[model samples]
Target: MLSDTSGGTSGFQWHVSGEGPTDNGVGSPQPEEEESASGVSDRRAKVTVIVLCYINLLNYMDRFTVAGVLPDIEQFFSISDGKSGLLQTVFICSYMFLAPLFGYLGDRCNRKSIMCVGIFFWSLVTLASSFIGKEHFWALLLTRGLVGVGEASYSTIAPTIIADLFVKETRTNMLSIFYFAIPVGSGMGYIVGSKVNDVAGDWHWALRVRLQHQTSHSECFFSELNVSLYFPLHFCCSPSFILSTFGFTTVAFVTGSLALWAPAFLFRAGVFTGEKQPCLKVPCDNSDSVIFGIITVVTGILGVASGVQASKKLRTRTSRADPLVCAAGLLLAAPFLYLSIMFAQASTVATYVFIFLGETFLSMNWAVVADMLLYVVIPTRRSTAEAFQIVLSHLLGDAISPYLIGVVSDSIKKSDSYMWEFRSLQMSLLLCSFVAVVGGAFFLATALFIEQDRHLAENYVPSGE
Candidate 1:
């Protein structure tokens, strides 16, 4: 056999003729070219993952900062508990409604450009929200909803991009790193919102500062470096759907309530007291925010990192690992959630400890569940799947949890008893514990179908490149 060894200076090419076989191997050596291509692919994938993680960070930060400053917002607007909770509900409603549209566009359009526009749109709306006067509460609500529309575009599509860049195991680790931002960002939102409100003397200024920071960061980090690079990278659920959706909904309900109201709940529980004017000598004791922030960041980082490692290890042995991990986390979280609420009226320190443990367990599911979704869905339908989950989860979960808690609080306060004010919040929050158990059960059910769905997805391949 005659073999052509060289085609171009760029790389060696192998050609075979029936004449003979080479002494060394069947194909010509092209180690340098192969290595170069592999290196570039790896570098691009890493850069893309980092950029997406940062954007995810900003998304959660903007979403939860309002919660951090909820008390100030409540006071400024003279709003009831129901109204306060309604703010989050409005945001989620807008987000859920627009998610499917973006998801459809994401699969068909240039995802990077869509994400860029979304980020820019939300940042602009956030900036506009800062200027909303106390009298213009309706305007604030409108801007918040618009911000949701922007976020929906990015959140539904980003994970699909990551899935295409890597195989299953690597994707799990990347997603864990990406989602680690959730708790960290939520915690920072609280700390930043509280500190900014203290320094600036108003919630409006606090929001403005954070929004401006996020805008600058996104433009500088993502728009300039990542948007252009994102175009080149192209690659890469049933009873699992129902159960996972139910689990996610319950988790979202619990998470939304905590993210939006935990700081205020603690304050009302006597862990901290509010100053009439925080800027009046910076008198507001920020110990609550600082402590909660520390717990969230530390535990969240560790929990997610460890969960990824565990899930990856378990997957080597069993295909059901991802959902099982989620189920375990939810199950562990339920007891701690109950403990946290039980201790709320008894001891602040115990309440904080239990809350810390509960958050740690709860955080474990974030990345694992996302990884499960990526593997179960086909490459072309991932965005749609994500959008559907967002709608279902929010519609049944966080969209109403905060408002329901608020309504419960307000109704209890209508009673003649003075203690009902605090007791009502405690009772409302306890619902999260029960919901956590339900979430755990759903995840457990998901485990039964996850292996089959994942195998089917892995075997099926799309025709086009």
Candidate 2:
């Protein structure tokens, strides 16, 4: 059931049965590694970091690509505000529920292979969106749901793999770099969507097309699943089951709603329309929409880069545990969010400032949380933790945001007024800000419990089996 806490110990014992070494014994190796003869751990950690970083990038790109082309999606399908919200809801819902299963598998299998399979499948889904016709609503929904399944596999496993590769103290830094892809990938997706739309006259086509893959799905998904499952069934016992479920459920609730309504609200607000005055004054045509999409893509990319850099520096000094830093980032982002919304009416410097700032703050949370998990959980337990995180964050964060906004917008005016739409989207920011504050508080509490070694013992098993 347990192992000793000496630094040189290998395998699962590094996490579970260790003593003398505090915080899951992650720090014990530092003093020994410096004096020892091998550089294997360091090299392994580097490779893991690089791989997961790429995974994070692809994950976000797949998610946001749809958002980038949302305006066209709404127009093509004649999707109502509520139904549009469902587009995001369906994907997130499937993701949130399935994450725990993937997390379980990651803990039991070859996480690397699982992640590769996920990326390959979701990329295909992204390519698939390119071919969907306007009336293929069911097909689109099904495809998006499948995309969720692919992401679920990757999201749960990657963090576990990273945790297995890195020690606690350095974990946050690596996680920050890896999670930085949320914004960068999202930015790239926007850029790609906008560029494709500019040339093809339809953004949906950009999202649905697929690229070539060298491997097969079963080989990827099952191999990882088997490795994790065959390792030990005991890891799935007790609190993990409950926690994983709760986490995934929370994420589905929040993110599902956010997907459907965020863009629709913006479109209604005339933000998507890129018009200055009130509604009906200028009927929105597909003619000029791509221009705003391009601006958004460029701004999002720059902001993501800036945020990633700032986060990297901040983590060096703050150990990525500073809730103050997280809080400050969100506070900084709020005004930009407001300004950007207002700026949708005008492409002024002020608008760009708001847009960029909003993205910067919005970008930090994932990396921060990812770092927290990589440091807190044992290597063998990381996949479960990550799966839990995905479930909770989305169920409570973005899953319901879009839908809530849509319902509220519909309630406020019950009319197709641009002013009402703008107001509705602006109001949703309040919720986003609130969630950020709550997340920051949780991070602060978690930090207090973190030992100098960078792992928390309240809920962890040593890495040794």
Candidate 3:
């Protein structure tokens, strides 16, 4: 008789030679044993996903919190626009550079342990940042860059775990839920940063407060998960990295610049009309942040939900569902982005409306694209693929965008006209619409190759098989 312990608490004994009796003198498993084994697997998968989603939520919240307080940081340091934007650029550069190493380790090591390390590292660095005095700006920048290293490990590995836990159709819905955190957390970052800054009277305190909240929450949840601590790490490095790079680069440029500067841009553009106070400690009217937060949270949730539903239905009829939906969303987003910028100076209400529409359309691709990647790549290679995508996307996209926009804005201000300064930012933002159009074209092209790639992935067999 052979003992099967794979079921953990519900282990059974089997007669491998087909001639011996089982543990209970029967040839088959007990009903209780079968139920216990299956139930444990199901429960474990659910718990794992919930924990990952929560972590992802905190991940993005930390990412954009600095952007939420960008104006205050600039003022505190007496930094120009380009310098302020370089903060984000530095973070992305570190993140992209470290992703490949993390990706390789994630594939071979215990991913749960890796995630715990990342969470702790970033949280510690974020807390350390709070102590950096105004004179130690470089120290603060270095901490921000370290936070990116921590984030890269978690972001590249978490989704692959999710992919392993679920099948295709169910995976789409689960991924939507997971990715919904991107916008929701981003919006919350704005609200939390602004509210904390208003109450604390310091940008450093604002960063510290948000980081503490996320860190505490993560610690509690990770403890409950009981991640394994022992594993040997191995390090590998994807073409989707190149193909997806182009589209995501364009998207990232717009999203990154907007996330970093939208509130400041609006404040300068006269949307807030609040009194300017000394020392940049003035609590600028938070209407723009609050409204933008609401737009992002609402539109992002609904867009991902709707996209999952649409993609699911379409997949039954066509192999091109994922990229097709992504292409259409990007195309639709382009016009709305243009209109949003056009109305920024004319009417605040119209601008908000267009932004809401544009965000909704643009968000449709997040879950679908992730799903496509999971299906197109084999399980063992998913981490490498994800890491490569992150490297390329950030390198070509957001890493340069904020600084580039700031550079453009500063150049336009050389004429020394406040109106032109405002116009310059407006024009710089308009570039996103054109980039969105290019991103959409890239997605449309992706539709042509995704079907074949997915088939190959699905049919792939191990060498021994």
Measured by TM-score, how close is model 2 to the native structure?
Answer: 0.72
Query: Candidate 3 — what's its lDDT?
Result: 0.73
Q: Which TM-score value belongs to model 3? A: 0.87
Candidate 1 segments whose C-alpha is farther than 4 A from its true place: 1-40, 217-237, 271-286, 415-418, 461-465
Q: lDDT of each structure?
A: 0.75, 0.54, 0.73
Q: Which of the two, 1 or 2, has more TM-score?
A: 1
- Give the per-residue lDDT digits (tens) of candidate 1, residues 1-465: 222232212122334444334547677543332111112246666777888888788888788878877777877777777889988999999999999998877766566677778888989998899888778889988998999988898888888777766665777778888899888987887788778888887777767766655566454232111111121112223667667878988889999888777776776677322222231222344456666777888778977987788887887898788788888888999999899877877788899999999999899888888887776776557777788889999999998898988988787775634356567887888888889899999999998988777777667754543
Q: TM-score for all predictions?
A: 0.85, 0.72, 0.87
Instruction: Please provide, for model 3 over 277-298, each residue's C-alpha lDDT reduced to its tens digit, 9 standing for 90 to 100.
Output: 2234444454566667778888
Residue 104: error of model 1 in Å? 0.6
In angstroms, the error of model 2 at 465 is 7.0
* Highest-lDDT candidate: 1
- Which scores better on TM-score, 2 or 3? 3
Per-residue CA lDDT of model 2 for 1-465, tens digit only, reads 122232322223323333344556565533433210112345545755676666566566667666666666766777766676667777887888899898876665545566667777777776676678877888888888888988897777765555544454565556666655655665565556556765777666556432432123223321121222222333333232333233323323333333334344445545445554332221223322333344444544554445446656776777543433544555465556666655655554565465555655654444544554454444546576667667666676566666665566556654465655666555654565454444444445444434433433335443654
